[model samples]
Target: MVNKSRMNRVAAAMAVAALVSVALPGASAQAAATTPRIDLRVLVVDDGGSSVEAITAELRDTGVPYTRVQLGGSGRPVIDAAFLSDVVDGRPRAKYQGVVLPNENPFGEGSAEMAALVAYEAAYGIRQVDAYTWAHPGVGLEYTDSGGYSGQLDGTQAAVTAAGKAGPFGYLGGQVAFEDNSALVPESYGFMGRPRAGYTSYVDAPVGSGRASLVGEYTHDGRSELVVTFGYNQYQQQFRLLARGIVDWLTQGVHLGQSRSWFAVHVDDVFAPDARWNKELDCTPGDYACAGGEGKESTIRMSAADAQYAAQWQQAKDFKLDMLFNGGAGEEWKAENGGTDALTAQLVADRAKYRWLNHTYTHPFLGCIQDTTTVPWTCVKDASGAVTWMSRAEISAQIRDNVNWATSKGISVDRTELVTGEHSGLKTLPQQGQDNPNLAGALADNGVRWVGSDNSREPAQRPVGAAQTVPRHPMNVYYNTGTNAEMADEYNWLYTSRAQGGSGICEDNPATSTCLPAPLDTDTGYLEHIVPAEARTALRHVLANDPRPHYVHQSNLAEDRTLYPVLDRVLDTYRTLYAPNTPIVNQSMKEIGTELGRRAAWDKALAAGRVTAYRIGTAVTVKAPSGVLAPITAPNGTKKQLLLGTADFGTAYAGNRSAWTGPEPLQSSVTLRLPG
Candidate 1:
């Protein structure tokens, strides 16, 4: 049994160490590359429980390659005479650093398989990490005790062993939710089990000539083995953190780099109206039929909402905001009068704080063909299913005009980044999967390096035309939060038919303020519509380490009473749950674009499989494949030569490479010769 007092001291010390690393971002990746790493992969054994997929997902996400074996159900392990020989020379002959047993049954006495595993551990000094349920003599406990702890306990008590206390896996100190029916190990003491033995959350057990920290323990032939346990899969995020710590521990501190995720919000369709904003149910002149019955255009007045949004932004400094503008609106405002609107002025005044991108001059659907029969501009599709697109010159004009307008307004727009109004002219071209050369040429001429796509269509980045296309999840405020009628109308208008859905929230005529039959409950919308979307986005980003740049419209902020309150709730929840002190980097869309481009370049280079390094008496020579952007991690600043092989390939790095933010793919090979 473990000593409770010693375990408590150990946990406290370990927590401090872990926090120190978390507090200082990038500390885990700052160590010199000269440190020798243990060359072994993890062996995951599934005993038909909830942890197989969960464990595999974490391993895959973190880039920890693993071999899996189904040890449950019909394939259950049995003790036969040949089992010892099979275990001694199993199919998974790869050198395994450790094993993971999820909800496993105890390998009974005299069992050949169990004996073989014990013999292997005794010979190799490799231990096992168990999650939730496991019963083996090697685990140092039996499930013979009838009574077990249950109910909603917050976490394990602070009786962690001294070794555990001084290590990185002491995450029981972190905020975690414990569920009902969590099994208890009767043999262990302190936070893990009944208070009979010493407080033993973790124990450095003596195994043959080597030492192993037993989170749970057992013995055979006077030899002990270590087994670390996390409660269950319900506590996935917390469980993954502990799993990561265990990987680090078992591998002797060889870092399995996990990228810290980032997030941003891009507000689109921000532009000046062709005419002074009005409250009446209105439409573009000569297009009255388009507005539908009592439908209003530009109903969300930015003049009144910009200040509120600014205040909310001040409160949420860690949240990134991108203002995507339609240059035509600003031009129209300036051409109409002296351009003195409070909304535009406020945006200009706070210009330095937010990232700005181009939507277009007039915000036309660039992917759609122009309808000459319409007044200003309209899109049409022919019988052949091809949507008519604007000419290259016309597309180029939209890009250039926007850049000029934004520059004149002191809004520094990154010419390399553009979010086509409605994400038009993207990979989903009507006829050919190939992009319109005209639009591609226009973007290239305008120096646009990155274009935005939607997760609804494509969840990852792809090359389109001359620009690299990055994606975001569309967080439409109109969805879910709006009332039953409001939700129905919005969905219908977008996907099915505008005539069928009516105009929904935009139906209210400003003049009477009573055009629409039903209105939105903005108060409850955040919880109903926004919270679900936010939670999904946050959890996805956390688990996959993918960047989620959620996109909304300027009108989303103006819709209903005000969108700031809802925005506040959604962002706050994400901050608290996914990333609190160890916060995700709040980045601009352009920055995100740049990061994605670099990642692509690195991935491309890594895929070519030509990276190699060798050193003899400090004369180091490295050969990196063409187009690889990241530096190879090898023994440096010493006379020692680092071992090189395919095993080192595909190792993940946590941050961006130096100055690798450009959209252009690397085009050449790199070779380095170092002087001793």
Candidate 2:
């Protein structure tokens, strides 16, 4: 018999998933029609109110260009009748696409400024997004002052109404943070009765061919096509979404200036002591040492490696390279630098030169199997040393200890991400998605934003715990031998090739049966072994500007000799081959991962096909989802300079054919386009 119920359940789950992925829907006719625009900008009318700074800050961060008109500023026009008349008449000087009322009525209620705004809304159907509560009635909304509701709710959860989910407010349609202590309620608003005509429980109905979006019940007579939220202290993410959405709705589709790609290099094990694993060299078949049964030989000297790194730090300091520094090597570095105080001072001085990422103290294989049994990585109780995962507490301690250690040493470490010891926990091993659950929880609790993973797992940026997991290219270039026991021999064969000076192997080695002719230094090994591996790995993601974090260990700075060349060459090669013309942006793993996550959100919004874009001559009109900043990829395949709103709204031409213009607030629509 067919299990119809089971099939139905599966179908429902799929539908829910689909809905969550692409939440925005088409706008209703009753709501204001999408306003097309050449540039995206809003007029921020501030009377030096409390919310002005917060609103403007978000505006700046989210790339919403705005022209500030401080009502209380000296020499500014008072909220008088003349100003109202000019504003309502759509004076040539008032070239704005939209208006943002941050808090309270900039002008007192019933003032000419408030009346002017009302008239302006009537004359032009420009969108207005209000952050404060009291200004609702001034904009022609039927708001009962206080409406018998007033006070403070923080971190309140808000659910989007069914109507809201189907309307232009669908971008903010999910359950989000809501704070509304004082809200202007409509006289017709009732929570328990049969809903009123213009009431969606959250938003007031269309009054003047425009709708009012609200987090709480707010009055809207519809005189102005306004979106008002009587919320205070909203989550930054939610606030950003709301701000972008409002701009998109007002401008039709937002013209995100341009796109940018970022790349970074990671140097791990900077201060870590040379492990016993790195000293072995094997003679492969055809080498004279193969017959002597001397396959595994310890030949690397740690002191020489340390000296090279010490010298290289000067070059690193000079470059001011925004590189990721694995902090686990702090102790070793302290000892090498003479004392902990010196080490701390050195790191503190170099704070601006690099971003510190966690590499747990006494680094252990976070998830790698020690033996046949799947024991946790923190299995201190297990004498056999066969462990797979670390307990949640152990994982937490591992991360917290490293961060605390960094802090103690005056080294600021971003707790957001930790390059796991050997990239162990992030390995694509026994099965996909089979990660250490305890580690995930610990990371979430630590408020980490990103963690390192393997590029072979198709790493872009995926959510792991509460953080974005960004994996680097699998093929790595390091000072030490290959990771595993078997690879120790393979590492020797490659590291001591003719191109790498062909040294460090004895005659009659079991694997090669031959000895290397000369000793290969770290530089030679980098050229012969590491470069090719890195080149192959770079090819996979460099072109796409994917996060290809070229990782290296401490010893790679040198070999048996001092003053070696490895990391510099690696960086030079990456810059030359992967990003010749494109400027490389060396960001920390956390920054890169956070950007990836943001980009994903934008991509999702763009992919929804909800954006309506129209370009007329040099003018373009765009209607896009909120909380998204889409980059304008030129049709001619030009380098897209990011157009995130920095100052007042203006298009950044940057030699492109289009002559960009500043976005004007308080207007319904304008035309702008990329040059043909």
Candidate 3:
């Protein structure tokens, strides 16, 4: 939960890779990398660039292991290929495979050495790093654009364009632009900030066969005119587009090395019972088709039986997808009389294609602000009138009951697998600790695995009754916040347009105005459109953050059980790996749910004195003094043999010293026959 902040959303496709052509000014819709191609020796040449610290910091944040070799010596011409090889050989030739030009003239102790290093990049595939340069030649870099513009490596360029006007110079603080259309980020430095000025320039992207993928234009300002774009992870389309473009132009895939991205997709409204409810259809009496209206309703609501399961084998292919997580969906509408049959067949047919997850017994918003069953729920609500959930028993019922039904439906539920009882709300009760456990704990106790209390779905926080609630961040469990609002707000035209108060608040600045920026994020759209697609995209960004990430979709399951062989393999690559791409060998959600139900029943019996427990080595004997007396008791000196894996009956001792042993499967009766 956020406090004192307006709002934000997740990241967008282009935001991930803002790869643009400096020469073309308005090309790439983004926003990457190498490792597996050729194992080339790497060298780190340093120049006195100010952002060196920032660049290093970003690399470390990734937590990916890499070797760094620093070039050090008194001023000398070390920029030649031989210089790089000599240093690499002295250390470990084969070990080195990449280069970091954190600053300019990486090959050198001097400018002459730098020229030699540039040539080496051609021979051995080395990704050179230049934080910023002028978009057009005659600006920050010496790379002459085909546009007939040539400039020095610094921003100070003479007036060769005849405009006699200086180039656009400002802080490249937000995200580097891909083309000239939009910003790489949604902070104040977004399109709302970079207006087209006389000096604003762009370059061509495919810098011919041998040159880099891009060229640039430089301005006269001390700052670099072009902000070179790079990708950390390619969750969205940006990186793939750029990589393909580069590969096509250079005719090389080997140039791209070990870098990779995790892919996944989820179905909520897209291929679930939820979509069936959107429009009324006409059918027979028992048939769901009756009302031929456009909107959904009780009598004529849509059902999951048809959308997710009603399809014939051929139609099922439409629902197939490429993904890292198979986000389980809520399709209760399919459980209806006729719908149930269809959905059951659907699950049986399609279970093989995906992993099954326990989304919820009945996908209810566990912490819904208001009950839609009573009145249409809305985000805005009166404080005192805030909605509460069904009773704990009710919540438990929904979860347990659903798991049983799913299992009965032939879905191989891994009960150890879990999804939030209700995803968007708080996972716990207002009170904390064991006795006052939250939804996650309840799910755990009940054998449901992978509980997410609250997610970054809403991505908000506020002062609630003088309390500040912060979200919990978990990798495979409770993924607190995914993306920020500022990043998400960029797609919406309203956020970019300037108003009377001004829509230009720098995210780097304090959030004093609604227009003020916050941080990198994707949007959640307006309050209206949170269809299942919303959930899928949200999960996509979350998986994108971690390279080769395994997102355990406790919420997903397949329609065909036979396809599980293949699904499991795919899941191994994407799910949590106790060992890489290996099976969990642990309990599934179905087993957990069943065991939990059994335990709950057992506990109830025990509370009624129908059962007990004991250590492995306790002995006792029961004796009756009178036939008509109550529960029998044994003398203090008596001992009883304790059996393992068996229920413990009460010890035959008198008074408070009387003890009990193991458990009761499910009985609420106890006979007491003691001597008075």
Q: Could you say which candidate leads in lDDT?
A: 1
Superior by TM-score: candidate 1 or candidate 3: 1
lDDT of 3: 0.30
For residues 1-676, write the lDDT of model 2, one tens digit per residue. Answer: 2357446534643443343212212211212343322224556887564445556654544444566777667887553323322221222222344667764344543344554554444333445655565323333333422232233323344455665444434434345443232244321121111132343344332323333334432234233343344443223323433443344444433334332224465656555644333233344222123434344433222443344355466476333333234355556565666765343354456565566678776566666334423321222335674344667777777788778877776776677777777665654464324566666787887877778876766556776667777777544443444333323334555445455444444332537543434443433554564454445345334323354465655444435321123434534544433213234456677766766666576556545654444432344555556545444322222222224322323332221112123223532332333333
Root-mean-square deviation of every model = 12.3, 24.0, 24.9
Q: Name the Cα RMSD for model 1.
A: 12.3
lDDT of 2: 0.46
- List per-prediction Cα lDDT, in the order shown: 0.50, 0.46, 0.30
> Model 1: per-residue lDDT, tens digit, 512-596?
3223233224345345544554455455454345665877666555434234554566455445433233355667666777667
Would you estimate the TM-scores of all the predictions? 0.63, 0.46, 0.38
For model 2, the superposed segments whose C-alpha errors exceed 4 Å read: 1-261, 274-349, 372-388, 431-433, 479-541, 560-582, 633-676
Deviation in Å, model 3, residue 217 alpha carbon:
20
Candidate 3 structure quality by residue, lDDT tens digits, 1-676: 3321112211221221121122112111110111112221223444444333333332332211233444564664434444543222223111223344543333323234443443343333334444333232222332233322322112111111111111111101111223221234332110101112323322222232422222222222212223332222233322221222221111111111111223232222222322111211311122233345334332222133433532342143322331111122334444445455443454456665554555555555554344333322333335795434444565555567666766665666656544443343353333211111234445544664334333333222222222222222222211111112221233232223344223344322445323323321334432222222233343343322222112322222222111222233333323321112211122232332333333334334433543221111122122212111112122223332333233323432111113322212242222222222
Which TM-score value belongs to model 2? 0.46
Superior by TM-score: candidate 2 or candidate 3: 2
Candidate 2 backbone overlaps, count: 60
